[model samples]
Target chain A: EADIYQTPRYLVIGTGKKITLECSQTMGHDKMYWYQQDPGMELHLIHYSYGVNSTEKGDLSSESTVSRIRTEHFPLTLESARPSHTSQYLCASSDLTLGAGYNEQFFGPGTRLTVL
Target chain B: AQSVSQHNHHVILSEAASLELGCNYSYGGTVNLFWYVQYPGQHLQLLLKYFSGDPLVKGIKGFEAEFIKSKFSFNLRKPSVQWSDTAEYFCAVAPSSGTYKYIFGTGTRLKVLA
Candidate 1:
């Protein structure tokens, strides 16, 4: 079982409002990632962190910003929400063990965000 | 550029029917392949993965996948599918060079009718 968790399993907000999606893990993983997905579509990487205070932008460009102040918490913030930003956001974390059997990532339940 | 493709966008199967879903990757170098399943209202979970040794890897829930290096294909298969197996399946690949970033396919939606 995965220990990752995300708050506000579903959200509905008006356009231009700022919103933050919360993600946290109890497994004490060193690597964390955020992915965006439209309904019935492939997941696109948006943001990731190697460790506390380390962040990098993923392949697909995203308007949201993420912070890694604590190893267990990685929060994504959208300055101004828009209809275009409506999608399901998934959070995943993986351990730092460098080996064949340890590369699998554990995913959170995901947050379904809707900007009206 | 690395990318993954799932040939089937949606699949419908009757109970006790054999199942196969095609997946191909564009990376030339060695890769680690993974098959993940997402049930309704649930998070993504690893069904199985192929790392190095075996070309055929078995995952949880009676799922298996064969990795063909020459074809750059890792196709998932099940001997017989049940209605409980209905879900969205995703295929992902990551290079073995210590980069943990994964490229995922669009996913295949499986519907099993009783």
Candidate 2:
């Protein structure tokens, strides 16, 4: 029921290959985030953007990079994929409001990347 | 560093049983608490959040959480859980002082048997 969307629900690529995961939202949200999660595990923040042209690294260290040229588009790219990067990449967006007022996040379907 | 802790790694319950998942955070100043749920084969969804006002805050799907500043805890509770409640739950917190970055816990897996 979320407005966010991610392409290639499942992906499998060999090591050293380049890959890019797509994320977009129609909600025009100002804050976007990229979280890495195992099949049924906790979520680790990898990247986030406050708005267009503003991107910051999250709590977790990631080999991938992201760009936020457009408000609705925030794509993540990996220069060289590794097996360690095999995890579900979840994209989410939320309002920029400070507190309360349904600060809930709307998550996309998620991209399951498998680097073999 | 601000961190969130979920005491239960795995929880099992029968249909119509009550459910409560404990969440605690370590931060000296003001904080923002949140609970997110990820259903089987689905992305994470917000369950509830606490920013200000009353200590107890309600969320979607009959879920609620209480933020006790003195205890520095925000525990998720459901009076009655259904089989559809089987999923992974994560607790996160954002320090009131800094940006909108969040620190999340490892998460708790819940299994509701029909």
- What class would a CAPRI assessor give candidate 2's docking? medium
lDDT of 2 by residue, A20-90 (tens): 89999999899899999874456789999999999999979999999999999999999999999999899
Every candidate's CA RMSD:
1.2, 1.8
Off by over 4 Å in 1: none
Query: What are the per-residue Cα lDDT tens digits for candidate 1 across B5-84?
Result: 99999999999999999999999888889999999988999999998898999999999999999999999999999999
Worst 10 residues of 2 chain A by lDDT: A96-105
Error of 2 at A59 (Å): 1.7
Question: Which runs of model 2 end up more than 4 angstroms from their true locations?
Answer: A39-41, A98-102
Q: Model 2, residue A44: displacement in angstroms? A: 1.4
